[model samples]
Target: MVPFGRLLDALSEVPDPRRAEGKRYPLAPLLLFTVLALLSGATSYRHIICFLEQRRIVLNALFGCTLKRAPSLNTLRTVLQMLDRDALEEAFRQHARDLLPPAEPGRMPVVALDGKTLKGSFDHLNDQKAAQALSAFASAAAILLAHTEIDVKSNEIPAAQQMIAELGLSGVLFTADALHCQKNL
Candidate 1:
């Protein structure tokens, strides 16, 4: 795992989408808090908030969190909704790249590609199905390289193709499900 301070530095440049006048917390710290909570097995906004609340003392001592109180679930939801998705993804990828060891000379990385429906994502109130995402994993390193969401109207085939191509892998061994072994691909 990357050092927490380095992680904070990597995320410091992310643009905050909140109005300046109403900004209660810095975007970098808030994002760091959320990511830390997620890494600790927080799977929902409520869980993340609770994690922050419970670990407030330790977090403040370590990271100098200056929050008067833990952010509410609504605040977290709004910030997440308004966050720049592309910027966040790029930051995450850069951090992951820093953590990954360099490939050996004349050796290619082995990457696994797959798609899975996100559990507990079904929108029962809206009568919508669970969200599906295509992911790329560096096999040896056991870390996710990247991912893309499958459009609601489309299947994994197209999403997988786009994700693999965007990865710009060269001299790399790509493995995937039978669905991606199309003759045209």
Candidate 2:
């Protein structure tokens, strides 16, 4: 596998004002990229560091850097928390779009929608006003297409509509349970 440093070098082609001079570490993009890479299969931070260290030779050959150590976990967390979620989401979307195969002109993709609460990640800090999310699934590909957060007291109808609106159903078939049969939905 190509080392993550190499990947970071490639991504660095995109200019970011956030990368100003005198910064202690390039944390946001580095942490975000590292997390995503780890999620893909990198075992641990040490493993990532080892990978990067090996690629350091290559990195120095391409772009000069005097780095010798991988970032600590605490550093990674601090950097990631500061990252702009919308920017990260947009980057993810663009990358996903690029990875997708071209769709045939006449072929309509199948889409399914549904919602469920993530019981494990539930939070109750706001008590009665806490937000809750329901997930919509595209059954054919078994991928989650969209999600909507419902108010604690609100029903699923509004959330369903919000999720549906985010999906592109032109020629695509949508399937859902009776809960989604509401007129406004």
TM-score of each: 0.83, 0.58
lDDT of 1 by residue, 13-123 (tens): 778998988699788888998999999999999999999899877887788768777888999999989989988887777666666778899888889889999999999
lDDT of 1: 0.85
User: Clashing residue pairs in candidate 2, if any?
Assistant: none
Residue 27 CA error for candidate 2 (Å)?
5.6
Alpha-carbon error at 53 in model 2, in Å?
7.0
Per residue, candidate 2 scores C-alpha lDDT tens digits across 1-185 of 23344444434443343456535655433543464457657786666555555555554454455455556665555555665665554444333333334455876656655656655554566454444667655454554545556776786777666656654445666676798776753
Candidate 2 residue 116 C-alpha distance from true site, Å: 2.4
Cα lDDT for residue 79, candidate 2: 53
List the lowest-lDDT window of 10 residues for candidate 1: 1-10
Distance from true location, Cα of 170 in model 2, Å:
3.9
